[model samples]
Target: MGAAWEPGGAGVLALPSGRLVRGRSLRALPPGPPPQFALYLAARPVAPAQWESRWLRWLDFRLPADPGAVADALREAWQRAATERVEIACAGGLGRTGTALACLAVLDGVPPGEAVAFVRERYARRAVETAGQRRFVRRFGGLATNDPSVAE
Candidate 1:
């Protein structure tokens, strides 16, 4: 896997295992190879035609506001990363997508508070930009608790 930064903070970051995760900008892609799984966290409703495969699921962050939802998505993405390829994307990459990827790094065994830094150092110098995004990373659970809402 390889990573390249793009405009709007949307870029592909290569995992340690050689898989790539794109934040937000991945939605416009055409299906090719199926990763172990794919997750789309959208603030708005997406067309059903836009989604493909049983491994794919659509999540809304606006309603039902379960912050833990990011953990569930991370679990699936990590599983995919271990074997097949995986990708997690959101609107701006730095905001929601970066936050989710940072939490995913925690799920990948990075410490909760340090997860954001890990991603930032490896992916981009400015990965998580918002206070809320940093808080999400700090609250992210390591291997012990998979709680999505784990408050720091």
Candidate 2:
């Protein structure tokens, strides 16, 4: 449950329930299979040093003005969360981070329509605090809500 999110593109944070919430740096693809579970955040242009990574696979891209990365991350997150793993997606915590959280919320059984509010209330009061980011959350795929009305 309660875990401090370290500053980075995205990472895997272990929740109190022993779940792994993975964070990732939003970039392009390198032609390969996506991670087991992940959440992507589409933010502004990233510098070269931001591109630097040793362990996680780097999806090469200057930056993002789209939701491709977020979608991929959400897909992974959904798979992991289904197994009761703690999945997280963040971009400096707040805007992009909140947006990714909202997507994760949807994957965690929150209604696609109310995913933004769900993330904001549970993850952060300031989650997805932007029009563009909100839009991304609304459209993101990959979800597993417990609410029968919204479950898929």
Maximum-lDDT candidate: 1
Lowest lDDT 10-mer window, candidate 1? 55-64
C-alpha lDDT of all candidate models, in order: 0.56, 0.46
Q: List the residue pairs that clash in candidate 1.
A: 24-89, 24-90, 68-148
lDDT, residue 18, candidate 1: 48
Per-residue CA lDDT of candidate 2, range 70-100, in tens?
Answer: 4554555545554533333334455665666
> How do all models score by TM-score?
0.67, 0.49
Regions more than 4 Å wrong, model 2? 1-66, 82-91, 142-152
Global lDDT for candidate 1? 0.56
